[model samples]
Target: MFKEIIFKEDAINKPEKGRLPTSIAVLCGVTILALCTLLVGALISTQRHSEGLQQVVSSMLNKSGVENPVTAVLLNFRSYDTLLEIAVLLIVAIVMLPQATVSKSLSLIRVQQSADPGLIMSSLLRFLAPTLIIMGGYMLWTGAYSPGGAFQAGALIAGAGILIFTNVQYQVNMQSFAFRALLSIGLCIFILSGFAVALQTGQFLEYPQKYASAIILFIETAATVSIATTLLLLYLAVAGTQEEFNHDA
Candidate 1:
C-alpha cells in the first residue's frame, strides 16, 4: 500500500510534456509587446536630425590619430570603460572554472590514442603559432601609434595558446598555488600601474613620461599571458583533457 501511494504521488508531481496554456499565453503576450517596442524605437530613430549625430561621430573619428577609428575610440578615448570591461571579463573567467568536484583531475587524462602528426601538419602548426604570436606582439607594440591594441593582441595570444594546448600533451598545474598567484598577477599589475600613473600625473592610466611605451608593453604582455592561460584552462575544464588535439593546422 505504501509503494502504491508513493508511485501515485510521483505521477502527480511529474511535469506534463506540452507547454501549459498559461505559459503559452504569457509567451505570446511577450512576443507581441517586444515587436511593438522594436517598431516604435525604429520609427523614433529615423527622425530627420539623426544624420547630424552620424556626421559628428564621423568628424571625431577622423581626428583620432589611430588608423582604425573604432579601435581608437574603444582603446584610447574610452579607455576607462575598456579597463572595466577587461576586469569584468577576468572575473567571469575565474567564476566559470569548476571547483565543486574533482572534475579537473579528469582533464589531466588522455582519451584518444596518441599518434604523432605527419610532417606537414606538425610543421605547419609549429610555424603558424609562433608567427601569430609575434604578429600579436607587434600589434600590441604599435597600438598607441597604430590600429591594434591589447584586445587584439590578447586574442591572438589566446589562439596561439590554444594551438599549443592542442598540439602537446602535458600535465598542467591548474590548481597549484603558483598558478593561482600567476593568474592574479596580471590584474594586480594593471591596477597598481593605473594607480601609479594617477599619482604621478593626476590622470589614471596616463602613461608616465619617458616610460609610456614600456608601461604599455608590460601591460600588454601580461594581458596576453593571462588571457591565453585563462582560455586554455576553460577549454580543458569543458572538454576534459590535457592531451594534444589535432584541431590546428
Candidate 2:
C-alpha cells in the first residue's frame, strides 16, 4: 500500500515538472510570433513612407544651417533625438559602473599582470595610439562636410584608450573626480549649449544662422570627449570586475 501511494505521488509530480517547461515554451513561441508580426508591420509602414523622406530632408536642409544633409538632420532638424540618445548612453554607463564602497581604494595597479600583451603589442600601441587620436580629430572635423561625426571620432579615441589600458601597467579609478567629470562632460556641454541657444533664440537647440557652425562644432567636440571617456570607463568596469572576481577566488 505504501509503495503504491509513493508511486502515485511520483507520477503526479512528474507531470507538474513537465508542465512548467511546456508552458514556458508555449509562452516564448507566442511572444516571438507577436514580435515578428509587429516588425513586419513596421517595415511595411517604413516602405510606404520612404518616398516622402527625401522631400522632407530637402525642406528641412535649407533652414538647418548646415551644408551636409546628414549633419543638418542630426544636429539641427532632429537635435532633440540626438540629445536623448546621448543621455541613454550616459545612463547605461552610469548604471553599469560598480557602486563605491568604503573598502574601495585608489591606487596604481597592473591589469592582467599575468597575461600581458607582450613587447610587440606594447611597442605597436606607442605608434598606433597617436595615429588613432589624429584620425579621430580628423573625423570630428570632417563631419561638417563629409561622412564623419562625434560618434566616429569618439569610437576612434576609445579604441586608442583601450590599447593604452591593455598595454600599460596602471589601472584607472573610475570613482576619481576627474574621471567622473570627463564621463559626464559631453552631456553637460550639450545641455548647456541647448539652454544657451534657447535663451538667445527662444527655441531649444535652434542655432542662430550666424553661429550655427561654431555651436555645432563645439557640441561635437564635447560629445567626442564624453563618448571616449564613457566607453573607456565601461571597458575598465568590466575588466576591473573580472579581475576582482579572480582575485577573490
Candidate 3:
C-alpha cells in the first residue's frame, strides 16, 4: 500500500513529459490552423473545378438515367467508388460478426436479463419500429428521384432493428446461413451486377443507358437490406460484450 501510494505520488508529480498547458494549447492551435488552411485550399480548388461541371452534369443528367444528381453520380457516373465503399463496410461487418452470436456467447439467463425493457420502452419500440421501417422503405424508393438514398434508408432501418433487438427478448443467431447472407448480400449484388454489365459493355458497372434506372434500383434495394443487417450486427457485437447491463445498478 505504501509503495502504491508512492508510485501514485510520483505519477502525480510528473508533468506529462514537460508538456505545459500553454505548449499543448499552442500545439493544438497550430494543428487547427494547418487543418483549416488545407480545407480552405481544397474548397477553393473544388470551387474552381466545379463551376464548369454544373452545366455539364445538368446536360448529361438526362442520359445518366436518375433524376437525383447525387444518386446518378454514386450509382451511375462513378459506381466503382460506391462498390469499394460497400466492400469496406462488408469487411467491417464480417469482423464484427462473431460478437453478434448472442445465442452462443451469452447464456440464456443473461440474455433475458439484458433484455430488461420496461413497459414504456417496449411500447415506444413497438411504435418506432414500424414507423422506421415504413420510412426506410419510402426513402429507398425515393432515392432515384430525390435526396434520399440507400445509405440513409439503411441507417433508418438499422436504427429500428437496433431498438427492436436491444429492447426485445429475441436472440440473434449469427450461425444462421440467412444471417450471414444478409450481411454480405449487398457486396455480392454489386459485384454480380458489375460483372453482368461488364460482360455486355466491356466495362464493369457500365450499365446501358436504357436499363440504368432499373439496375440502380435493384442494387440499391439489396444494399439497403445488407446495410441494415450489417449495422445491426455491429451494434449487437458491442452490446453483447457489455455484461454490466445484465446487472441492476
lDDT of each: 0.63, 0.79, 0.82
lDDT of 1 by residue, 11-109 (tens): 866644544578777998999999999999999998666564446545665444444555555544565776677677678668866563333333332
| Reference-based lDDT, residue 34, model 1 | 100
Q: lDDT winner between 1 and 2, please give it.
A: 2
Error of 2 at 124 (Å): 1.5
Best by TM-score: 3
Q: lDDT value for candidate 3?
A: 0.82
The true-structure Cα RMSD of candidate 2 reads 8.7
Q: For model 2, which pairs clash?
A: none
Candidate 2 weakest ten by summed lDDT: 101-110
Ranking the candidates on lDDT from highest down gives 3, 2, 1
Report RMSD (Å) for each prediction in the order shown. Answer: 9.0, 8.7, 6.6
Listed in order, each prediction's TM-score against the native is 0.62, 0.73, 0.77
Supply every candidate's count of residue pairs whose N, Cα or C atoms clash at under 3 angstroms.
1, 0, 0
Q: List the residue pairs that clash in candidate 3.
A: none
